[model samples]
Target: MKQRLGAALAWLEDRTGLVGIVRTVMQHPVPPGATWWYVFGSATLLAFLVQVVTGVVLGSMYVPAPDDAYRSLEFITNDAPAGRLVRGMHAWTATAMIVLIGIHALQVFLFGSYKYPREVNWMTGVLLLAFTLAMAFTGQILRFDNNGVWSTIVLVKMTSYVPVIGDDLGRFFLAGDVVNASTLSHFFTFHVFVIPGLIFAIIGIHLYLVIRNGISEPPEAGRPVDPATYRAWYHDYLRREGVPFWPDAIWRDALFGVLLVVGLLVLAGVIGPPEVGAPPSPANLDTNPRPDWYFIWLFAALALLPPGIEFYFLILGSGLFFIGLFILPLLANRGERSWKMRPWAVGIVCVIVTGVGALTVYGLQAPWSPDFATQPLSAEVVGATTGPVANGAQLFHEKGCHYCHRIAGSGGQRGPDLTTIGDKLSENELIWRIANGGVNMPSFAGTLTQHELREIVAFLQSRRSAPAPAQNVPTVR
Candidate 1:
């Protein structure tokens, strides 16, 4: 049996040369001292493979039609066999791909691996990163929930800030003047077909460049990359100390890839997929749509950026950032490779990580958006059980005042805390403010009747930290 199997294998190899190609790839020499840090690139590739497989499974099940998409998601989440697990795996692997690719790029940048012949490699990597983010944005919109729909609308509106083609871009994304069934179909095609095809092509180029340029050696503090003689020096150095990639370096990558897959599986089994929000409804004022965690930083930035410059910051700022990434190798292709010798590189990475981390935390908190889910103020917190003050407290909640204003520490912080409004404003002033709202506050004049408005004023008048002073303070407005 062994002789027959060997004969068959030899026959196939002679005909196709597949065995020779595999042997050549497996026996490629890698630089010495290429350690676990080098595993991220392979791990990222593994994550992308996972994404592709799981995405195919989901695409087979998901309905792209606007009317049926949400219902289909519900069925998959609740009824389909192993559907929830597959969905969770897809979501988690997408996150893993982004994170691993980011870390891999940072590693390459710090190591100065983009220098000399590898400049194109770094450019391809940057394109992959951008494509990965595009996939994430499109996937979020494909959820077809209210939050997803509004998030896409918000993105389209932001796209409208681009200089000459802003409006055109927005219309293209929406597939018309407004979002409809076509918008969903367009996003589905981009996420599943268009963006993935670009990513696959770029990944092919990236891998080829990796093979062409060879893996960079661990950086030494005194060693600086010089394009003139670097390739010859690299080849000579590899001849002296390089190891075969298969049994030597590939083991670490394989181990790490296996561990990453196991970790993703565990997370998917334990946590499941993100909860689907309500059906799409543009008229729903109570909805506070937010993007997935990966994009929360950008959401926070757009919200926190000073009002007038948002257009510039959103357009020119992002454009410049990406432009900088693409031009980095051109600007400093030959330099000290070690972080120990490049303090500015370290500082840049630190600033970016810190800024994004801080913004993400703030976005999760989201103090700017009203808390529509806040429960009504309890009777104990209201400090009244009956009469005008109590009735006013009930009316306060009924009018949705508690959603924006904090009272006794239990409401939203979007507006000022009204826990002690009585000490600051008189009854007439309180009445006037409630009737005619200010900037962030909507005018309740048309919404509240005279009696209900007075009740709300009474409730506000009862909110005081201490007794009023003997001297009467003048009211403004």
Candidate 2:
């Protein structure tokens, strides 16, 4: 890094009359009036660096299967020694990166730094902000927790507005009825590589443009070079005010970035990523789910809405908002750098910020969810019947209970592991279900004799208290 920094500084100092070089932009030998506030961009760049490195580390450890996902995360957090460190760094850095970007963008916006030649820069920035948030949302759900699942549920429904393609889109995104390995892998690839790749290209483009068009300073005064005569560059300009990009630029970026990483590490050690209440199970239809904080507002918004009107407006509103956001650069490409004259453009930006902020705040505070978490396994859960649950036992095996629920650690996860069924369900609850079946379960009443239901109920619960083996060894002295 030091060698690269040296080479970059040499290259910068060698530029031919590079008037827009960092040193010149500062005004003083150091950008005369430039305040530390200007460092927001530098800080943002640092955070991005953290995201790339940390995300790669996280990707290395993460498992993309929905069923295995919760366990994989647990392993990352609790079992794999470095798993916690890697995941913690990646998760917290991601959050910090977005926030830093937002602060940078907002600072520039408020200061009217994009008034003239910087409009394109600011516009590109806004798009970047959206991308940052997009990655955040996708990464969060890719966790596939009870929260992740339900968050996707609400999101899928919201997307129902993509004409007739909505359902297909949702299915495609989820990789099936619920999030699956495909969803995890897809999101992982996007989060760690694809999106970051695009972001990198954008960063290159954004920086190159910054170089081409001189940095925009506050509305203060300067030699108002007519854009036509301002032969842009700084190689020669270095003799007048330039500093080596080594100790000057790269050093600051690296130092601050390290500080940010250390700070986030401490935070993660203290707080940790919020754990989900439970892993999602489609078989348990009544589970109450919510999304992570970044999305709490959206969840809250969905709650506030009177079902029909709320979704319709949200769909339409979000679509139009994004469309407008993407097209803003072209719309403001008049190429003017006069912040004083760009009230309307600035206003548009403020409007977007305000609207998004208000919605986020509202969504976070609103109370909107099912009245009851798990519908109490409704009395109708299994339905009217008195019978031997032994039939239910046969039904269990026949219906693939063993495929998902485990007597111990043996079974598929197509549903929740049922090793502890007795701890939760009563005999009546078990028997009623055997006779009638509930939720994803098929009714055994019509197929099983009353005695069969009894036997199966007995069979399913019997394993709960299976005896422990006698001790084999004593504690070491």
Candidate 3:
């Protein structure tokens, strides 16, 4: 049986030159001292493969129609065999792929690999990043949940801000004026077919470029990339110091890729996929729909933008981002490759990472978005049996104070927590702040009756309980 199997394999290899193809790829020359930093590119590719397989499995079970999409996902999560696991893997791996790709891009940028012959490779990478985000957006819509619907609406609004043919593009994205049955089908087609096809094609081109131009060598001090001489210099360097890519250089990539897959599987089994929220319904005003974590920075930025300039920022900001990316390689095709020597490169990266990270944290806390979940203070907290104080407590929620101010952990963080507001402010000061809105806060002088204002003030004045001592909460940075 073994002899027969071997003979069959030999016959196929002879016909197709499979062994020779494998040998050619395996024996490609890699620069000396290539290290684990080089593993991220391969790891990203592995993650993309994982996404393709798991996504196909998910597609088999998903229904694209608006009415059935949510139900179908629920069935897949709760009833189908290995369905939850596959879905979780897909979700987790998408996140991993994004993170890995960012790291890969950052590595290339820091190493100055985008210079000279690799300019096209860098541009293709930028497209891949955009496609990954597009996939994330369309995949969210596949859930057909409240967040998904809200996101679709917001996306259409965003598209409408595009210059020139914005209206047509927005309509095309929605498959109509608004999200309906066609919207779900449209997203499904793009998520499962169109976007993935483009990603695969781009990946093919990216890999070809990488192979043709060869892997960038580790940056050396004073070694500036000169477009005129870089290719010849690289080829000569490779001849003098290169090693076979197969076992000598590829080991780290293989190890990292395996570990990443294992991590995804473990995470999927332990945590499962994110829960499906309320079904798609515009009437569900109580829902505070938010995008996935990767986009929280954008959400935070939009929330923080001054009202009048929002549409302009939404349009111009995005346009400038892509324009900057496109023009970068063109502007500086040759430069000193080391980060230590490129102060501007280091500064730009630091600013971007810091800005995005800060925004994501702000979004998570959600100081700008209204917290509709704030409930009235309990009788225990108010310490009022009846009459004015109790009425004041009731009036607080009725007056929408709890939406912006937390009293003893019962309200939103959009404004300062009113848990100990009475401790810091006298009754008159409290009344003044309430009657005259400060900054983002709304004034109640006209909106509230005199008696209602007095009652609310009385309620807030009674909130004098001391806060608990702070615990040691870990800080990110």
**What is the TM-score of each predicted model, taking all chains together?**
0.78, 0.64, 0.76
Rank order (by lDDT, best first)? 1, 3, 2
The candidate maximizing lDDT is 1
**Candidate 2 residue lDDT tens string, 1-477:** 999997787777788546445555444222223455566677776777777776766666777776677777887789877667767777787778777887787667556565445567876777777778878877887677666655555665667557789869867665664445666676767777777888888887777666655444444433332334433422234346555444554455566667877899897777776664466543443444555566666655665567457777888888887677556545643334444565775687788678667878886654423222122122232221344333444555654455445545555543455766755566676775455332223334445556556666655553344332335111111
Writing each residue's lDDT as its tens digit, candidate 3 over 1-477 gives 999998987898899988777787889998999878899988989999999999988999899997798889999999999999999999999899889999998898888888888899999998998898899889988897766766776676677777888879978988976567888899999999999999999999999898889998999879999988998998998899999998899989988988999999999999999898776432343555667888888867877887547757977888888777866798898879988999999998899999999999998887365678777677888777687768878988877777778887778776678876667777777776676443335445546777777777777766666532335211112
Cα TM-score of candidate 2: 0.64
Candidate 3's displacement at residue 191, Å, is: 0.4
Compare the candidates by TM-score and give the number of the best one: 1
Off by over 4 Å in 2: 1-31, 164-168, 176-178, 221-258, 282-288, 333-362, 365-477
Off by over 4 Å in 1: 282-288, 369-477
Lowest-sum lDDT 10-residue window in model 1: 468-477
Against the true structure, candidate 2 has what lDDT?
A: 0.60
Worst 10 residues of 3 by lDDT: 468-477
Tens-digit lDDT string for candidate 1 (50-134): 9999999899989998779888888888899999999999989988888999999999988888887789999999999899999
- Candidate 1 clashes between residue pairs 3 or more apart in a chain or in different chains: none
